[model samples]
Target: MNEMEIVADRGAWRAGFEERVLAGYRAAGCSEPLARALLERAAKGIDDWTVATDGTEWTAVGVTQENGAAVGRIHDLTAPQGRAWAERWCAGQGAQRVEVRLTGGAGAFADYPVRGQNRMRAAAERPELPPGLTVRRLTEEEYPGWYAGEEAAYIADIVRAGALTPEQAKEKSDHDFALHLPQGYLTPGHAFYAMEADGQVIGTGWVNHGFLPGVTFGFSLEVYEEHRGKGYGRAAMAVGEWATRRGGDEVMMFNVFGGNEVAMGLYDSTGFAVLDEFRFMEL
Candidate 1:
C-alpha cells in the first residue's frame, strides 16, 4: 500500500479498459452502446495532476489537488490491486482519505460518499412528432432566456440528486452553462433550438452531432414550467430525434438522474430504452 503509481493515458496497463468500463456501466444499467473513443476522450489532457506508478505502466487515472488529496477514476482494475493502489495514492497525496471512482469490476472501496445514480437511455428510432409542434434554430435574442432556464434546471437537478447544496449547485451550474452553451446556434456540428407552437416558445432543446460521428446526443430538452403536462416535452424529444436523423443518424442517447421518474417515464413513452445506471463514490 506504499508505492503504487496511478497515471493517465487511459490506464494503458489494462488491455481493454473501455470494455471493462462499459461492463461496469452495464452492470449498473446502461443499455446504450458505448465506444472506446468516448472513454479514450476521458483519459486525455490531465497530465499535471495525474499519477504514474513506476512509469512502467499506468494502473489508474486521477488528479491530485492542492491539498495533496488524489481524486479521480480508476479503470479495468481488480479489487485487491485497485484497493492497494488507492490506499497508496492517498498516502502519496498526504491525505487520510482519497476519493476515487472505480470502473470495470471493482466494487465500492468500503465506506465512501455515494454519489447518486444517473440512468442512461437511448433510442435509435424516431418518435412521432406531435401535430402542430415545430422546432427552429435558437435565435440570438432567446439566448438569455435559454441560459437562465438551463441553469435553473441544472441546479435543481444536481441538488435533487444530492450532489450539491442549493448554493453550490447554483454556482456550478452558472459556471458550466457559460463554458458549455454557445451564444447562439451557429456552431458547426451542434444544433440548439426552441420549440414553438403558434410562435410561442414552449421549450428549448439541443442535439450534439459531435457526440459521435453520425450519431447524435440529445443534450437537453426542457419544457417551460407553465407548459408542463401538455405533451410539449415529448414533442421536443421527437424533434430531437428528427434532428439527429436529419444529420443521418438513426439513434439518440441521453441520461436522467436517479429519482427523476418523470423524465424516465417520458423517455420510455418516447420509445427510448433504459441503457444503464451510473453512480459515483467518494472515498
Candidate 2:
C-alpha cells in the first residue's frame, strides 16, 4: 500500500473527523451530549505529527515519551492502508508500541494481538435482583472510605493497562472526582451503593445519571474478593439496571480497561456490546 500524504487542509480534515466521531458514537446509542463530549476529548491534541489523506481518512497521532521509551496513540484511523501508514510512521518516529482507537468496528484491525480500552453499553431494563441480594445507598460516613479505595484501584488499573503513568493517573483521578462528585455523597446526579446478600456486605457500585443526557453511566461495579464466582457481579448489574430504569434512563453504559477478561465476559454475557475500542499493537 502506498503511504498516505500529509493532509494540509487541516480545517476540512478536522470537520470530517469530528463528524465521523460523533456519528460513530451516536450510532452506538450515545446521546448527543455524550457524543459531543467524546468528540471534544478525542480532537483536543492533534499536532503536525498526524497523518491523513484528503479523501475520507485521517489518523491523529500523539506520542508520549516515558522512561526513555516512546509510545504512540493513533486516533480515528479509517482504513487498512491508513493503519499501515500509521505503523510505519510511528515506528519511524521511535515509538516502540502503538495504540489505535477505532470507532464503528475493528474490521481489518481484528488481528491485532492486544486490545486497550473499551466502551460498552446495553439497553436498560428492570431486572429481578437475585434472591436475598439487596442494595442500599452508602452513608456519608461510608462514602469517603469507599471513594478512596475505588480511586486507588481505578488508577492502578489504568496504569497497568499502560493508558497512563502513575503521575498522570493520579492527576486524572483527582480531576475526575472533583468534576463528578464535587458534593461527595450528596451529589445530585450521582449515587453510591453497597450491596448485601443475606445482610452481609458483598460489594459496592456507583452510577451517574447526568453524564450522558438520557443514559445512565455505571462508574464502577465491584464484588469483593471472597464474593467472587457466585453471580454477585451479575446481581450488582441487575441492581444498577433497575436503578437506571427507575431514574427514567433508557440506556446504560460504562467503560472497562482491556485485558480484564473476567469483567469483559460478564458484561458480554449480560448483554453489553462493545461500542468502541483502543487496540494495541507492538511495533
- C-alpha RMSD for every candidate: 5.5, 3.5
Poorest lDDT segment (10 consecutive residues) of candidate 1: 112-121
Number of backbone collisions per candidate, in order?
10, 0
Worst 10 residues of 2 by lDDT: 113-122
Put down candidate 2 lDDT per residue, 1-283, tens digits, no spaces.
Answer: 4457776667877777788889988897777887887777677676545757735566666677744568877776665577777778889889988876777667767866344545555554556678889888888899878988899988887777665679877887888888888888888988888999868889998988856666788888889889999989888888878768766787777888766878878887987877778777778
lDDT of 1 by residue, 99-195 (tens): 4444432255434443432223344465556898887888877777776776777778877765456886777676665665555446567677888
| lDDT of candidates 1 onward, in order | 0.60, 0.76
Instruction: Report the Cα lDDT for candidate 2.
Output: 0.76
Off by over 4 Å in 1: 1-12, 16-19, 22-34, 45-61, 64-76, 80-127, 182-185, 197-199, 268-278
Instruction: Pick the lDDT winner.
Output: 2
How far is 2's C-alpha from truth in model 1 (Å)?
14
